[model samples]
Target: MNHEITELKFSVRFSDCDEYSRLKLSRLFQFTEEAALADAERNGYGLWNMMKAGVGCAITRMKLRLNHFAPLLGENLTVTTWAKENYKDKVIYKDYIIRDGQGNIMVEGTSSWLLVDLKTGKALPPSASPYPIPIIKEEALPEKLDILPIGFFPKKVDQVQGKNTDIDINHHVNHCRYVDWVLDALTKEEMKERGVRSIQLNYIHQVPLHEKVDILRFKDSKHHAVFFGMNAEDMKGNPLKARCHFQARVGFGE
Candidate 1:
């Protein structure tokens, strides 16, 4: 198809940032996902169109790298996304880039998604789409997204419950929502004192509504703390929905 990258513009609000005035990771995901969705809609095959046709897209995996805190609140940022290619039938790969007004790259991401039937929740089998698929060249990650190397540590977790609002068109906890869960699990004092420097996530499974999830914390010498998320099962059990790792510091300026 076309050679243009789908771009979305955003002005960060106070609500979109951490206490340190850095853009929240979840909000960045929202902007990035919206850019991708808008591009799909323009191509006649994005979230809105899929929903209207009783289909849904599920982002199965995503990993993000942040070079610095997102431009401060109220700053304008541009996000661009492109499909990598038609991958294995219903699955496709996509890449995202976030840039500041100065044209510096702020965040880079790569994600994998599968289109599925709404009713069956099964991956749609290979079929020719009525529309032409845009070839999104895969963006190489500086560091690969793999299962976080879980270190042996005593379990110390903060709990959260998935809410109905967490479900998306796919009827599962929205992928980006997990970032909030991880952040919210932190104490207000903790959040006020640090800003996430960089973060990565690898989604393992879709979390269902109202499941009590655990944010398992680990001691990290490199980052402030390490966190692993689990749900989709009873609290005592372990069925991981996603894994996240991040580094935090005092942040740029105040």
Candidate 2:
């Protein structure tokens, strides 16, 4: 029995928030991702299950817009996810929406996922897929706008090494870690005062243990910023690792 749509309830744990008791941006993504995966797991396309079948799921791109800020510590939230039968890069496209207990949307986002071979790490053809994807009209977010790479902005760069804590079951840097690097670079004080209204990210390359990534940020003003960065060593002749385009708004979209 496959579900056309899956919804789950979660509580914001103590560890999910900052000193000010506000939920962190990266943690928000983590919760959303967790919900999506849990649903797929019940339908037989889960991480471990897929890996055993010689295929694995990985997110390639993500774009999120906030209608409101995340729930405070211990607040209950509802998260729903579904896949649209759209195929690109031999992968599936999924949409997500997170709401408070009142059913008012707090966050909405879309994501693209790839199915790759467990050993070779090459993407598999869509025809080879076994699970049935849902046909749902995705909830739309604002159109994407181009943001300049970090190299085109300020010169101050923050360097971070890929450590054990940074690695995930996929054996590379986890997706949430990338968001952490971005918000950390921007700082919590700034993020809280000027809440992030939206964020778009493209996963270009992976950061493995022992590798160093240079995170660069270019602030457009006190309330806006652009983040672009890449690994120190060139991968595939391109220094671009990942780029996060985000907007900072007032009062957490209230």
Candidate 3:
């Protein structure tokens, strides 16, 4: 396996930024995911093709750290992503986001993913003799970290009827759309006026199309809100499918 670093460039769009003129926290993850997908494709390990061969990639967890905020709409940015190592049943990937022309680091993150059998959706064991994993190591976060957490519980459950487009080759909602749901729940005022500094998410369960889902919302603070997604049963009277905690700031200047 090649361990060379792969990089991609993207521009910040009006939709990518919040009212504070910086890229939205969720969109940053989307961009980084895109970069990883593209890199995987270039490496002949694209998710779609992998599924065709009976394997699929699923993100299990992610940790993001924001340094300088890229708050300008239409600003060009570059994302560098590469695989790091293989674990027992999963592989890890790391990414760096930098402002395009100025070459400033805006954010950096690491994600863990497992390869699963498409037919059963169960994790596959790493090959006894798997390919050599990359050795590029980035700085790790400190032990005492201010990792974000989901701040609210979900309520008002609704199921999303699976549509033909709902199923990816991986047989689940496309990853980015999860962010879309969170963004969709936000009002235009929220999207335009709020700033998100950092975020960390753990993908505990997969949501299928046509599954009943519960939407829950609560304000953690004047500037922050929490959202949750769960099955209808849980929405009505159980736990949540997934909980998201968002940290927001107001009146940020680009």
Candidate 4:
């Protein structure tokens, strides 16, 4: 399948807003995904349709930079998405959010996607088949992890069991499951005492099916802690997957 640059427009909904009336951080990713998929469908290569043809698109990693907050109720917001470049095994996709009327930039994000064979659940080379999608030069990715600090420390490690239900059609852990992990890493008392205001995460790598990922947590300061996911190594103690950084806000009675 050929990757192409596509754009989509949507309105900010009441469900999308936070207490401050601004769009929630997590919903930004959801909106981006929706727009990108809509663009693909408009171009005749929707993700599900591609999957039916024996190809599946998988998000391997992502980086999001939130800029100006969008809080206008019923105001249209335009989301533009396109593939920056294509490699033999993966393609990089970029998304930009802007106010529809003024074109003011709201958020910018980039995600890396891999094409895989539906049967084997392994990555397929981009050059393995003729992709109808147009490819552009790859965008430069950030060298450092971008995330804010979350107050509080986890007293225990969280265990996530990847069952069949936890697996998506692509046979990997669902992206939302990562969010579940982040929330689960915190104790109930912590959540009751302090609400999470904002969060940022870089998806470094995919968690494979049936693999047990240990959720590790460490407090960097009084108001900040780092959380990551890791799998057991063969014997040398090398991590099987790349580490991801998660930042959250926690304080006061919500």
Candidate with top TM-score is 2
Tens-digit lDDT track of model 4 for 1-254? 65555677777799877555656545666777787678667766688678778887767656555454444566677777766666544554544444455787665666667777878877776655333555544443332333443335543377676777667665677675676577667776654455453344555556677776667676645554467665534212644333432333222223
Better of 3 and 4 by TM-score: 3
Among residues 3 or more apart in sequence or in different chains, the pairs in candidate 2 whose N, CA or C atoms overlap within 3 Å are none
For 1-254, candidate 3 gives per-residue lDDT tens digits of 43567788888888787667777766777788888888787776776677567776777666566665544787778888776656543455554545555887777667677767767867775452123234455533421223335555434422344456756656776655555565556667655545344545546566676765555565456545555565555545545433322222122223
Model 2 lDDT at residue 220: 58
| Model 4 CA deviation exceeding 4 Å by range | 1-4, 70-75, 88-90, 137-173, 180-214, 221-225, 230-254
What are the per-model numbers of colliding residue pairs?
2, 0, 12, 4
lDDT values for all models: 0.67, 0.69, 0.59, 0.59
Question: Which lDDT tens digits does candidate 2 get at residues 13-76?
Answer: 9998977787877888888788879878866677766667787777877777788655689888
Per-residue CA lDDT of model 1 for 1-254, tens digit only, reads: 35678888999899997767878878888887889789888777866666777776667667666776557878889888887766666667788888888898887877767777777867874254444557756574533345566655726466776688888766777777877876775677666555555555667656667766667766655545556665524445543424332211112112
Best by lDDT: 2
Ranking by lDDT: 2, 1, 3, 4
Superposed by TM-score, candidate 2 places the C-alpha of residue 196 at a distance from the truth, in angstroms, of 1.5
Regions of candidate 3 where Cα sits further than 4 Å from its true position: 14-26, 88-91, 128-135, 139-167, 184-194, 217-226, 237-254
Candidate 1 Cα outliers beyond 4 Å, as residue runs: 88-90, 125-130, 138-144, 186-194, 219-226, 237-254
